[model samples]
Target: MANGTTYKTCTCRDEKGKRLGANCPKLRRPSRGGDRWSSTHGKWAYQLELPPHADGTRRNPLRRTGFDTQEEAEAELDHARGLLALDEDAHVKRRITDLILAVLKNTKKLPDTEEVRRKARTHQDLNRQITVAEWLEEFLARKRRIEATTRNGYAAHVRIYLTPYLGDIRLDRLRVSDVAGMFDAIEEFNDVIAIERASGDPERIKKVRYRRPVGASSMHRIRATLRHALNIAIKQDRLRDFNPAAVVELPAVTRPKPVIWTDERVTRWRADYNARTDLARRARARVDVIGCYISTPRPSPVMVWTPAQTSTFLTRAERHRLHLLYRLITLRGLRRGEAVGLRWQDVNFAGNTIGVHWQITQLGWQPVQGKPKTDASDRVIAVDAETMRLLKKHRANQAKERLAAGDAWADSGFAFTDELGRPLHPQIATDQFYWIAFEAGLPPVRLHDLRHGAASLMLAAGVEMKIVQETLGHVSSTFTRDTYTSVYPEVAAAAAESTAALLATPSPSVLSHGRRKPSSARRFRH
Candidate 1:
């Protein structure tokens, strides 16, 4: 052997009819033949003596059999002795050698060296392979310090998509083709969703109701989860080179841009869409149909109201209980969850500021109060005097409502809530927003569009991009500028004209004056 290790091979049979190993001819004269095992035609068996454990207990010699030649059996024994070079614990080495021997005893073949090394590294079961499903579970178990909502999202991806598709693949041996094939299957599933929705028959839809392909956003999310999980696998050295999830392409996901609702479009919407019997239940179709002229998607334009229209809306909604909540969003660009998460403790009437530290999100329909969307979202924003006054009035109104409720009142302390002080569901806000928008005789805008309107209005007011970014709790000013500025074309044009006028002012040059300094530089014409 390579390390001064010794091994023995024997084929039992002797002239005296004894079956003892000492009588085997191949063992007696292994080197005398032209080839190492040419002298034997019977089954060959091999044995090795591993070093004693630290406790001074001796394990039985690793043994295996069923080879046509002694050299073949000895070659297998040499492979086990080579594994000892890893220099692990004494007992561990013996255990590993025994495992190799056990496999050899059954299959008459040595296991792959890399596979054996991985088993040693991770201390996983050598008898079974680790599958993607098992690794995903391990990944989630190790991933602490995440929000409950975030954890739920990751779990849903694993349970709903990954386990069903890629679970059986060995984690270490996953290929790009397998991931691509999985996405292809998911695409086919999308076709099924479209088919089921179009079928219109309740029975047909019920048959395959649960099975559907994912959307662009879901695909992005699942890919992100897989990429993160596989990245951890790479960092832990569970995978060596390729993160197959990293390379497989997915459909492009573009953030929807803001589109302003001009007077003409709103006129078309009120005249065309609102003039229907199903108007109350299908208010979203107002924006959906109106947006079609400008975009092909069902909900084409992410409509934002003009400053005048916004004022008109506030005037119309002034008496509504939720007006203060909508005003906060329009002025401060708070997300729905942030608005719903707002508490009286976070409101600073004295400082004229509102601290945005917590937010309430939905995991399905259950409201979960947690940290803000991002680190930047936990901010203190300055509120206008009118907005602060409005909030004070809203609080007094809520107090009166609480008094009327008498012992039935729930003191949730939320800035916006039901009469019982419970946190409002986001969908309730959505439904209310549509109702109010239609009632105000205005073009329909998503509640989120108010946030877009707020950012654009700030830009129009000459607020610095950095300040607008901070106000909106955007991670980067560049994202804030690019995303929100699309709806500010009129403001952009006005700003451009102002800049041109400023640059158009003529400044007297030395050449225009009687006295001129000597200079060799001359202007060149294009």
Candidate 2:
């Protein structure tokens, strides 16, 4: 290692405006007090040439300026020499060589010692030039403990939306604007999908085949994916400093409010629905336009029916093949998957309680058996006397059907199944429910909303909130109260009427025309 040279100088120009070295006359002698403050010396600076690598390659010189004294410059020079001296160690020398190679190949400037050490330890590429597609693939590969459904969802977003747009961009160089622009592009493409779906030409519609519009929910999911992926990249030290995904704007999510189908609304809707569906049948019959956009069912959110309407529906559905299935949902508040996943082992007719354990969830269109949505959801609920009666009848019917089928039974052991005794498709319950509601001239209440209506009915029947929460297997009573407190208008109206009765004026007849009601402060005589 070299001591490195320290020199002092002042700005001096010749007649040609060039600096003269120690040749300046002011440095000819020291000052009167032996002080070396000659006009020639203003400040001290260092100049050092680093040793060559073990590979015998030339290295650059390290230079520093603007030191007030020689000691200041010498101290810094010692630091430089110390840093370079570490290169003598075999491992450190190899890392230094790698840094030099990276600098040469990528035209990257030399970084500090600490930075070189980080690069060596992390083993990340010297230049962060990996594309988003490559990084996302790596991200997906490293995921091990997450559920299969979650991993599949991430993969779907990457394949369908992210790759085509952001994949080519370098992960390290991705910007907030780039993320924002991707969302904008998705929204614009959503418009295109809507337009294509509306178009009558089959060829034009084919352009968007197999594609669905990027709704607010999907956009929110995409943003979440990017945010998580980028966060992981930063956390693993694969990328540095910037997090463009964190800053991108997302649309606020608004959950749809539940609506109850009261008698008046049901009557009107039944009439309109029967007429419209009948007309659709006639029109599709004439033109054979069954699958065209004109006949597409409007997107319907969760819908529930009044208690009386619910009873009417149950009466009409009782003779159907799946009467007990609808009754359990509308009366007991079972989620669609839970109803489909019911097994004989989980049922306890003697105890009059039904145990909800396994649920059949969909990964795409394929059903997968999984635990209930939450630990609380795996519950045992008591059945009412009427419900128990209905269950007994349903069990007898199932037994008869089983006997008739003989060896043809699927023996899947599911409490509910199709006519052939095979496990029923979970969605078929919803479709058949819609058919029954329409054919029976009832309001279009979705199957899941039957669960909501069940909760409402329980509350209206003076069931305690905690008991209702437990019956529904809600994790907390507050959620049960908040979500359904207003759903049963009758309960709230009763509460209002009860409160008003307490404050009602006692007998206006006793007021005596112009009197202040004989002063409510006077003691009453019995």
Could you say which candidate leads in lDDT? 1
Where in model 2 is the C-alpha error above 4 Å?
1-216, 219-253, 267-283, 286-300, 501-526
Best candidate, TM-score-wise?
Answer: 1
Give the clashing residue pairs of candidate 1, or none: 189-213
Residue range 246-323, candidate 1, lDDT tens digits? 655455566467778776666665565444424523543223332222122213336788999898888887868898
Query: lDDT for each of the candidates?
Result: 0.71, 0.69
> What does the lDDT read for residue 421 in candidate 2?
74
TM-score of 1: 0.48
For candidate 2, report its TM-score: 0.47
Please give, for residues 18-137, the per-residue lDDT of candidate 2 as tens digits.
886535555445667774645345667677775566677767655566678778888877765555554466556555545544664566334445445455566655444578999999
Model 2: lowest-lDDT 10 consecutive positions: 287-296
